[model samples]
Target: MRVTEDGRGLQGSVAPTPPLQAVVWATGYGPAFDWIQVPVFDAAGEPRHQRGLTEAPGLAFLGLPWLHTRSSALMGGAGPDARYVVEALLKRT
Candidate 1:
């Protein structure tokens, strides 16, 4: 289904079969690490790193677009990156 341009409701060829009781709209926007006490952002304010791996020791990132793959920001993408970061951290210890 497609959301109305005004965002009041969904606009589609067919109505929902079960009828619509509630709708949750999730939107995507740029990341804002303003509160982070780290120097990981670039001039554009995005993270300065390679595939979510920052140069800061013991610092790593996840759930970022193209972090490990094209789906890095998605649900399944965090697992592998998380594991890799964890292993690296363990090795440091």
Candidate 2:
């Protein structure tokens, strides 16, 4: 695979490889959380959630940008958001 001249895209050929062993994708943040799929996201690829509670049930995401406030992505904010998610999880149980 090679990157486009613009460096904003990938151009490659998909060919068969040996049988599955494991696959590792390292997409370190930046609106590219493609690994999290299904009903968890809306049409815009943003998580379908309220606060930290995701639509996938039981599963939740904490510390995402603007999760509940401008500081939601901060370390300090994770504690509070985690508490909220824990409460929500308890309620669901």
Candidate 3:
């Protein structure tokens, strides 16, 4: 498949293909987060964080894989990271 230069449509070659009623494109690119309207992420569009803690006060993330451990994205891994974030929040309070 080829993305349109305007980044709005796709083109592909498929034999005996029916007219597309709808198309859903899934790109593995990083999150846009453009709708966030916050100064949390860096220039790269990734949340500026250290172990799920962002520079913005009272802002934190969870369930990010490898945040602090290999399992950080898993339910079990979320516990430790949650504790850490909570601890930091408490300190600020």
**Per-prediction TM-score, please?**
0.60, 0.60, 0.59
Residue 31 shift from truth in candidate 2, angstroms: 5.2
Worst 10 residues of 1 by lDDT: 19-28
The Cα error of candidate 2 at residue 41, in Å, is: 0.7
Order of candidates by lDDT, top first?
2, 3, 1
Q: What digit string (tens of lDDT, one per residue) describes model 2 on residues 31-92?
A: 56564433577777777678867655455677688878887787767777777777877777
Error of 2 at 53 (Å): 0.6
How does candidate 3 fare on TM-score? 0.59
- Model 1 regions more than 4 Å off: 1-30
As a whole number from 0 to 100, the lDDT of residue 2 in candidate 1 is 44
> Which runs of model 3 end up more than 4 angstroms from their true locations?
1-32
lDDT of 3 by residue, 3-88 (tens): 33443444445522234322211112233455444477777777777877766555567766577899877767777888887787
Q: With candidate 3 superimposed using the best TM-score fit, by how many Å does residue 47's alpha carbon deviate from the native?
A: 0.6
